[model samples]
Target: MISVKNVTLRRGVKVVLDQASVTFAPGEKVGLVGRNGAGKSSFFALLNGSIHEDSGEFSIPPQWRMAQVAQDMPETTQSATEFVVEGDTVLQAARAEVAAAEASDDGMAMAHAYTALYDAGEHDAPARAQALILGLGFSVAELDQPVNSFSGGWRMRLQLARALMCPSDLLLLDEPTNHLDLDALVWLEAWLKRYAGTMIVISHDREFLDAVTQVTVHVDNARLVRYGGNYSKFEDMRAEQMALQTAALAKQADKIAHLQKFIDRFKAKASKARQAQSRVKALERMEKIAPVLADAEFSFEFKEPQNVPNPMLSMLGASFGYPAPEDAVAGTPPTVIVKGINRSVLAGQRIGILGANGQGKSTLVKTVAHALTPIAGEISEGKGLNIGYFAQQELDVLDPEASPLLHMQRLAHDLPAHLRAGQGTGEQTLRTYLGTFNFGGDMVKQAVGTMSGGEKARLVLAMIVWQRPNLLLLDEPTNHLDLATREALGVALNEFEGTVMLVSHDRALLRSVCDEFWLVSKGGVEPFEGDLDDYQQFLLDEARSQREAAAASQRKR
Candidate 1:
């Protein structure tokens, strides 16, 4: 068992944990949650012995073998499989001993070392490493690719795979789902379920914590509070506790009234027959989560669009993908990702894009956002179509060196005079607008490059809401946001009177904001027949099939 008894941990002058006490059993899967900057990472640092408690006691079994994903970006020429296989310290040590023994001409020592290596599962190490890489979204063709050849996010995935490769008594994962797509996240959940070691994870993703963890540890006001259930149960307990406070009572009343109004209006207004059933389900879902959102410290809403356009866009046999390089030969063809897409995006429709990793969900969204033009067929955008797009890589469209104020100023300058009527181009006016999105005073002038990922994501959202777009194309917008901010976004999207198309691994967000799903798979786009649960099952089956295929290939070798 691991115990932190009245621990006082600090970083500089910041009191991260003050007399906090918490305990974990030998095989507990714990979800560590708190607001951003609430010392979740610091607490993790303590566990891994990267830092120590300034006062009181913190200890774990000395013999426990620990594994954690390295935060550093990997810069290596080693093949992906080989790199991951090396994560097993025991196996590596045993093999090294055997080599050393043989070099010294010690026959008995060599025999013992070889037996130790065998006991450490050296027989199937390659297959185990390959499985981990594949389960984390790597393709078969990329197994032998050098680690440094991949992008930053892909390299991070490799790091996660390597950590999972290690045989340990304890596993610590921090924001493990940030780089994963929906399909990959599903696979990871299953893998963690099968992990025998005691696990502690720090994640902003609500559904992820709920699915994989049986207990939740909340860092609140410099103390670690233990809860016996998952994240939802913790919220429920929080709601009950907060009910006793007068201020919280007033807030809850206001939110309840607000949700009641929405529910009443939603039932009365049925613009589309197909969406009626989904709306009913969404109302029930809202009622369940409203109290939780009401408990959040911050909130914002999307501005009403200037004009609403029905059937915001229509794609007729559209093929979306990357075009051939500019310097390519004349006859070189483009690489089509999602092809033969026939779909219509209407006003006020909430769509969740579903697909396995690398299956073109982002490609289709990019095409709609006009970031990438369709390689073939036609995209008929409605008259006066205005889109607010949030890329999966939010940094892609942002000027990292520019301040939040400067970004808004540039946006104001880019807008036509007619669109700039109410939103002023003046510095003070832009600053005030930025303030509405929580960018205040010094933060307004702070360079985005130095800001945290969550802040940058918030800046992107603020810019999107400022546009007053009729259609929102959000791709993994919640990747960097904390739980409270995510709840805020869910409420904001629910209140927005516009079309929404989102691609995210955060199931909670998907359930809250989206009523319909579009599947981008097998190089085509089609309406998904079922809900997120069904899609998760599909992903699981696919993962199992992949594992079997990979094992079979390994056997042949």
Candidate 2:
């Protein structure tokens, strides 16, 4: 349904896409993969016509409409329903024309309006809208909520719902699963599976890509390479391709060396000179294979302090919930969100918190970090426990006006003066710390506002690591990270000797880095001894049990 041919996109002097060609067929789900800053978002923007390429041939079939789910939500004060309804401009106009005709009592206008309404299938619009809303995880009551009232994640969902509601032949989604919970992600995957149009999604979630996409389009070194399978298949194919290329290159190198040796040895020999020259010419004409090195991997080595005692953070009979207004005391006992939470983070414990969205995972992390006081029960810290907390809303703690260096300097200033004695001056220490986080040279001087989301996250993490805390509390730490960075952080965390309490939806990272699972659900915390897959199976079993219990209850009723 859409084709890009010889597309060359440039940002200033940097070439993002060079003679890249790709095609999407109807009902095709294409997964776009690349490392961070490798022009995945730029490619989407070019396809969406939000930005024009320097030189390219992009084709969309005539009468084929397109919609893009943007990473940033558009600034708007409109109600969610209004925004979604407005997405279908023709339908909205037809409805308005129908209303006007009915008000004026014009017979000809009424006939025209009725025809328009019928042609547009106005009766089906409401049902379609409701389906889109629910599919994107919005409740019925939230349909009328102002778009501005929702957080960035929810607002992105609203934008996606609006795009999905539109009658588009092609959909362009960039990082659509970044903010989605597992349930919503499943819904989106199902929707795309049954969708009648084409879709191209740029996402870092391997599982989502595998579940939704049939083709993988890789953007590497300013070129587009298509792999005819899901992500896992693509990985296998890519590895084989690299190995073949390496072997071919090795053979070519051996041939070239042998030919050169022949030329050197037979330069004065009349009989062998012609054959040697032919070999030289063949070598010159041969297309040399470029080395297919794997993408650069990020390695995070956290410099944590040594030898901390057990039970870095512990809680007993903990209960936590946001306080309702005193005048609005109509609920029963304020509806405790989490209770009977008995958990401990020993010196070597690597615990992962898992649950659905808005299930008090963040609240539990805050309580463990001592950022939130539990309404009931006690929390205790071991002796000499140093804590490093990485909150989900990292931007809230960053100063927009400060440079990266300045931010680190301020953080360093808060450290004990005795520790700073051998660490050089404050500016030097900050620069050194920034370098450790891969923000060297000009990057350290850039303002925090100008930094990318990944950069800011890394900077915050670097600051935390500099303190060398004995215990760490991380909430959705991989939210803005690319695959390489996520793997790097996971490796670092897995190797760290300190206690860790993490809340994340990245199952791969959790499985690799965590030793146990602390699942928050239905107003309580349950400790499970296993990896993410085990916890996931536990959830599935629990869900099945709940369904059986409900059926039994219904039969009893």
Candidate 3:
């Protein structure tokens, strides 16, 4: 068990936690939730002993082992499997002991070292590491790749796998689903559900919290408030508590009014003066209950398109991939991941593109958005077609050094002459446009590089909508956004008058905004027959098949 007693914490002059207390029993699954700057990360740091509280005490069992995902991306030449296997400190130490025993030619030491190896499960460590890596979304072939060969996002997934590989009594995960696709998210949910240790996770994904957490811990008003159930249940309970508090305040106010009325009438008469003085004292001693402040609510919408063109874009026998090396001569083949992609995106079509990571989902989106050229075949466009694209890597569309207002200025300046008409050149016009995305006054002048990921995402949305494009290609647009902002984006997309093709792991957004689904798998694109739930089951079956195949190959060897 772990206990926090009257803890006070501070960062600089800001008081993050004031007299907060909470307790966690063994094997309890708790969901930590709050606004972005509510000191959730600081609380995690305190539990890990990297931070000391300003006052009070926090205690955890000294004998219990802990595991948490590292935030730093590792730069190493080690193979992915070896890196993850090294997470089990006991297994690694035992293997080293066996090596040393053999080198020293000590039979007694060798016997003890071999025994330790067996106890540590050294023989099955590789298989265990492989299982974790595969479950977190790595291909069998990529298992042998060097750690440095993977991208930043994939490297984070490796870090998560390494953390899960550790033998621990307590597990801490902070935003573990940020980098995962829907398939891997589902797999992780299942894995965490079966974990035998105490787990505390911080996440903004409500559906994931509802599926995995048994309790909810809310960080609000510089204090920790514990609730009895998951996120939805907590919301319901919180609503009831606030309603009851409001009623109590109202009743108190009515009693005070009656007492004051009596005191005013009787204070003038000498006979009832004693009773009036008693009422005065009672009113003076009464404690006033403060009204509850409501949580901030955010909402916004996209401007209607300037034109709606039928069949906005179409592809015939198209191949999507990267171009050959610069040194290669003419006719050097391009590396194609998806081929024979014949599809037409009509006006107002809402399509959700689904696929595992590295299976060419982003490539297809880039191709349709004209960010990349199709290596073969034709991609025809309609008359007056306007494309608004949101890249998964926000840096692709944002200039880090520029301010939000400047980005809008560039967009206004770059528009075609006829389209630019009536759009004002004044700074007020730019500020007004950005304000809808929550960038007010001083925020409009802040540098994009210094802003948070959610702010950068909002800036990107503001830029995209300013042009009034007839088609939108959004890839993982909700990655940096919080739940409220994500809901706002979904509302805007649902009300949008243009065609949309979105690639996101946010199942809520996908289910709410998308009406049709396209599956990109095994180097081909096809239509899917069902909803998000059906797609989740398909992924489970696929993972099971791969596991069986790997086992068969291992037996053959």
Q: Name the candidate, 1 or 3, with the larger lDDT value.
A: 1
Provide the TM-score for each candidate, comma-separated.
0.96, 0.79, 0.87
Instruction: Estimate the overall C-alpha local distance difference test score of candidate 2.
Output: 0.72
Clashes of each: 0, 0, 0
Highest lDDT: give the candidate number. 1
Ranking by lDDT: 1, 3, 2
Considering summed lDDT, which 10 consecutive residues are worst modelled in model 1? 270-279
Which ranges in model 3 have alpha carbons more than 4 Å from their true place?
A: 96-112, 239-295
lDDT of each prediction vs. the true structure?
0.88, 0.72, 0.82
Candidate 1, residues 1-557, lDDT tens digits: the string is 99999999989999999999999999999999999999999999999999999999988999999999999999999999899999999999999999999999998998999999999999999999999888888888898999999999999999999999999999999999999988789999999999998999999998899899999999999999999999888877776677667686685788767766766676566334343455566566566656666767777889988888888999998889999999999999999998887889998888988998889988988888999988999999888799999997777668988999999888988977756668767889888888877789899999899998888988999988888899999988998899989978887887889999999998888876677888888999888877778888999898888888889988998
lDDT of 2 by residue, 476-526 (tens): 898788766775675567557688888876665665455557778788888
Residue 243 shift from truth in candidate 2, angstroms:
4.4
RMSD of 3: 13.2
Q: Identify the superior model by lDDT, candidate 1 or candidate 2.
A: 1
Let me know the TM-score candidate 1 reaches against the reference structure. Answer: 0.96
Model 2: per-residue Cα lDDT at residue 470: 82
Off by over 4 Å in 1: 263-286, 289-291
